[model samples]
Target: MTDISLEETIRSFNNTGYPFPEDKTIHSLFEEQVERTPHHIAAMFRGASLTYRELNEKANSLAYLLREKGVRPDVIVGILLERSLEMIVGIFAILKAGGAYLPISPAYPVQRVQHLLRESAAPILLTQTQLISRFSIDPDEAEVIPIDLNGPVYTYPTLNLQPVNSPHDLVYVIYTSGSTGKPKGVGVEHYSLVNRLNWMQRKYPISLTDTILQKTPYFFDVSVWEMFWWSIVGARVSFLIPGGERFPQAIIETVQTHSVTVMHFVPSMMSVFLEYLRNSQSDIQRMSTLRQVFASGEKLTVANVRAFYDVLFIQNKTQLANLYGPTEATVDVTYYDCPMDDSLLHTIDKIPIGKPIDNTQMYILGENGELLPVGETGELYIGGVGVARGYLNNPQLTSERFILFNPQGLFLQKPPLDPAKTPDNNPPLTESFKGVQGGVFQKAHLLYKTGDLARWLDNGNIEYLGRQDFQVKIHGLRIELGEIESVLSRHPLVRDCAVIVKQFSQNITLIVGYIVPKAENVSSGELKEYLKNLLPEYMVPNMFVIMENFPLTPSGKVDRNALPDPSGLFGTKK
Candidate 1:
């Protein structure tokens, strides 16, 4: 095999999707929209709407109070609240006060919330009157400011507080699920987030008349794009009321009532919503106002894509986009627009994750860091501007995952450059930088190892194979659980499914499946036969259990840990 030059390989996979100036921070861009469309509705929750000016003023008031309490550059502020207008305000206020906001979801367990508060070490916390009692922290440890206390904090005058940080300063630190049984905080700078938001606006423009639905919890990175992207473009953001996410009818009604044009969903939730549409016999025309639907956080199966196309896009002009990214890549890094052609849909087993977005580059690398060929499967590494600033307070873990990559030996001879002097400089060194203080200054470019197995297609698209760790070996044959789940999802009666390896003994393990059936009468025997046709016998699950609904994490993805053990269950034989 001929060796491909590093420059050629980089040029082949890099995507300059849409270019936008990165000179401004999120707060500055949001203020520009406020200046242009002060009267436009910026956000709405529970029958209350705040114009751009009103929202800015509320945010400014909170910022003023925060500044009085020593919130400044490099400071970390915690936000604990429900899905309400104040939650949005808290986000902007933290940015305006020159601090990185740590979102603590109200739905999280008390111990988990306490862990985040203690791990992040956020000296200041913003919460409402109702949620103040939920915190397990002592008042002496962190100053708690309740926004709805009917005090001067709420009635304080609104003023423009000049942003004190540069584009590279930390904007937010979001905690994602870690395999080590603890949540890791990913610190994303303003420049990385602004680039993502600008690309979304350019690719799928949201007009002032459009309303975006904010149903995901604020703690998740999906909400980062959903809540702020619309505001940056002067579009209205409609918040979903409490308990609304569990009920499909409530979401549908909110979409119809607000004429929501844009929305995002995890594939599991999307499957449920589509099932609701089919079972209720609802008119697709009523949902015609929805022009674009974005799916991410999980694999978008071919069957779910086809169902969405047949029910929503077949007679309307809506477009379904399949996005792929982890929390470390700032929400999304790649996108694929599902075509309406049934022939094309039938031929593919799994939808391609599509091309990289603007200022983003993806590479499939072998175990030894060599570039893999188009059809060869390897681990996916993300580079370019969207790479996060590494995990907060965990430098060893950060250095392990966020590696330095110089494909062409371009920086081999150059001396180490200070991170503070880099063109896109982040905040000054903090506790998170303790372990890497001396070494990080020498790197040329940081690439985040996604730990996901994928391969490049001939058409320049990437096909995601499941996580590298999710690959299991049974009876000397390596199997990809996602492949099995994909085949099961294609069955007419299977709405969603999850596959796990259950170890019955020290040397023996069995593949078990948990499924949510579309029809009550669907049988596991039929699903086993369906799998036999599509997958090898070794790859097929040994047992199948039907569930009314799969348990979900706070981020809306299927919770694998909550799956019940298949004890005293009979195995299916081929």
Candidate 2:
């Protein structure tokens, strides 16, 4: 029987809840850090560096300017800018002015951008002068704030109002690509951000002398942690451009040029990086400063992890780690410090995503909500301070997932306060529902149903199996198959689409999309380019297989299994 309350567990684990710090908001943290370390370099992108003092003044200037135009907290302000210091400042400015920042990647389609703007009801949008024409929005219908980092600016706000709340306030909302349907906004509060950053700082201890590569897009949750973390400690943040088709090379050049000591990448990006490394004919040791490499957004395969350790980190001893968590869980819940063991190489099909950080608790349970014995597989449930406050404006989805949890074991409570009421506590349920006859009492358990399947090993480490539904994790990002189909359905060349995850190797999962073209002559390469403009490079299907029609299941839904295997078109690993 678990004795810990959810609230108690969070407190003990040092998880920060919303509305924290009592007096400061997310913007205030940036402002305070900037003021204290004015001369330090805060951001670096393509040979450009902005000092703390400069970043603060620029952000404040934009904030003042935006507020003058009636922008305020709770207002959704869209940001569609390239990865640069100005983009960083634009985000801070929005937050400082009490508005939530909504980042729309230019890589997405104009219609997709417009759809997000409409869904968010964002009244104001900040854009780069170069990409203004990409938006399908009418400027007259909304407030458009244009910032030419190299050009002139008219107004900069000078307000010094004390922030109304603390770090627990809503910091931003990042819309993830929905495989099940349209993109859903993931709300991350200031409290969760602070807690995550604090945990990272303590664990990695990145400092002013350290240089970290900000490879992920600013809109990605990983980027949020990356930008602020380096700023807080006076370290340097090197932003990479949206590499388009040349993403692998972009990552390589950044690491080589910046002498980046720390970096984060999704598995897809990492695979590309490794592929580039193998083909470049350059000395592997050229990546010397990369002291640590972390991969998430998909399962870290044994082969991939082993290759990285052998080829990239062999000479450098760069510590490689696998991080796992959901967006609703604030970036990461658990981590596995990868080991360089040749004997266990083949056994690396699934890496233990380590234990919960600080105050998080994870459970592996059987189908009926009972803890499975060691070496048994079951659904995984996580309870921690890292859990988000459910999805934004998604109450029904939230209710279904975030359920009421009682940790004192199951009970059939009798009528209120009856003196003779029997104790409500029921017998502690085991894997087989066998009542404990003589064992000592254990922590009372309150179970949460995670749709994921996992197994507890003899070593007490849990190994993730796979999803119980059609949900897929591509390059570490959760995607719903149905969501991809919805997006493809709207494409000009696509009449219909069926997306599936093809496991080519134990470590490699590819999103192979089969499309029924509106025009039979539509080429795969052409459709691929079309998608690049609408989705992130990672979400774009690796193999686009055109089909005449989708096979139907007996139940009338698209028969996913009946679709021809894509490995024939795209070569498999063994």
Candidate 3:
């Protein structure tokens, strides 16, 4: 199709009846892609690259090896690796072995990581020799399989393991930082993943000639899509080492070197990229080969968005977007292909995440569960294939968040089994679940209560109004204070901890952790040092406060409301 025709086709399809794949299971799609493009470049990590043929063979071999070791269908396996060629192999190998992969970031606290591994009951842990010390459990407790990409030294046995994924078979369980508690594992089914991958390929259309880049840690769900989707299309997916934060220059070099046509980044990282491009010695402004630039994880501010088009898109004519969604939804639910018209620039306050992608349906609802009319403010509830099955072992919390509703009846009901057990046809929960009466509706429509607040614009797009809770965005990163508290409370020196999103500036929110130390002698510097090893640098609190006792509210709860503001207490205002 001609360029205009292709764009028109995509727009028309989305406007009319956008056809999604019937087989939602990842196994079938994975098999089909491997069969169709065996010799095409499936993925690239630094100097190492794998063709579809090699990836399939390697996965098949690992599958057989895993089965020989007695790993079976429905089993969960922990994958602890950085963004590398081996990580991709481990994922497909787990799926091929009829098991699911649970991504555990090596940077996570050993205690929390161990909690997730034990909570999920994953039987095997996959990692590299460099990360062997991060495993929290004894090797004897669960199988620890260290991937020796360079020195396995022997051919792996080959076997075509029949795909055993029921429509509900688990694919991967990703633990999102919990704002109110420890990190909770969000379980995604094979079909949900398949639907997402299929939709992404159809919408984004990365091809054999496209070279994609995997920048996020493998533990992040977006990385999962980065590796597999490119594999399906025989596209090259380059890897950025973990230090891409410190060496944005190297990332630019890699993109230039590989002639990368497609890349994904969080808004914070995109800022870093745009900053690097503006200041760099390399004339990135002239590199017109880059085609697609996708950003998510946080809103793309007006200034940053404009700077992006001025430099990146003006040069490359690339697609720029503010893709939106939480991990509970599969990577993204909506995308707004950014507009570049100068006339519309002044009126664009917030880039709308645009419409729901493919099968996903979004509802703006009032506090009472009623569907807010257009131009009304309400919480955003998402539905359809992009919605996750639910949290991995926390049924109460899952049921609380993922509700069932009937659009026609406007009723809400608590789901009985895991939603994964039920098909999507349980009923269409189109309206928001509100009030006590909302509990009676039980068709198949699963309602995902996104904590985000949004309002419909007169133009039919939704504008995000930030969060209703203490949750806040820092450096364009979405963080839940509960998640920080959960991780901090686990520290031996911390007797009690409270984490809150304290905004020091209009653009900056710092994670302020207030801790009651086990002893009076603990120092804030020492606590920061301890957290540096236990969590991702972003998750580490920017400032620490040691308190002998927390203020109490009338309700007898810790009075977080009474805590001194960071600007006043710390003398550090953003």
Best by TM-score: 3
Q: Could you tell me every candidate's TM-score relative to the true structure?
A: 0.78, 0.80, 0.85
Could you tell which candidate, 1 or 3, scores higher by TM-score? 3
Candidate 2: residue 101 Cα off by (Å):
1.6
Q: Give the C-alpha miss distance for residue 359 in model 2, angstroms.
A: 2.4
* lDDT comparing candidate 3 with the true structure: 0.71
Candidate 2 lDDT, tens digit per residue, 266-334? 766677677667654474566778888887777777877877776776667788888877776778777
Q: Supply candidate 1's per-residue lDDT for 489.
A: 79
Model 2 has an lDDT value of 0.69
Model 1: per-residue Cα lDDT at residue 78: 93
Q: How many residue pairs clash per model? A: 0, 25, 14
Q: For model 3, how does the per-residue alpha-carbon lDDT over 1-574 read when each residue is reduced to its tens digit? A: 4645533433332341233444445655666777888777777767778787787777788877777777666688988887777877888888888888898777776766677778888878888878987565766556787775774711676555776666567788888767665677888777566657766787888777888778767667777677677766667777777667446677776777777887787776677667768764355743456788878777778877887876776666777877888788878877788887656766777788777676666778788876665566789988765678888878999998897755443322322222543455333322222232544443236878999998766555667878888666665455677776776787888998887767665445678888888998888788887776656677889888888888889988789988767666755568
Off by over 4 Å in 1: 5-10, 15-18, 149-152, 281-283, 407-444, 470-574
* Candidate 2 residue spans exceeding 4 A from truth: 1-24, 157-161, 244-249, 275-283, 341-349, 407-450, 458-460, 487-497, 503-557, 566-574
The TM-score of candidate 2 is 0.80
Indicate the worst ten consecutive residues by lDDT in candidate 1: 426-435
What are the root-mean-square deviations of the candidates from the true structure over C-alphas?
Answer: 11.6, 9.1, 7.6
* Candidate closest to the true structure, highest lDDT: 1
Better model by lDDT, 1 or 3?
1
Candidate numbers sorted by TM-score from highest down: 3, 2, 1
TM-score of 1: 0.78
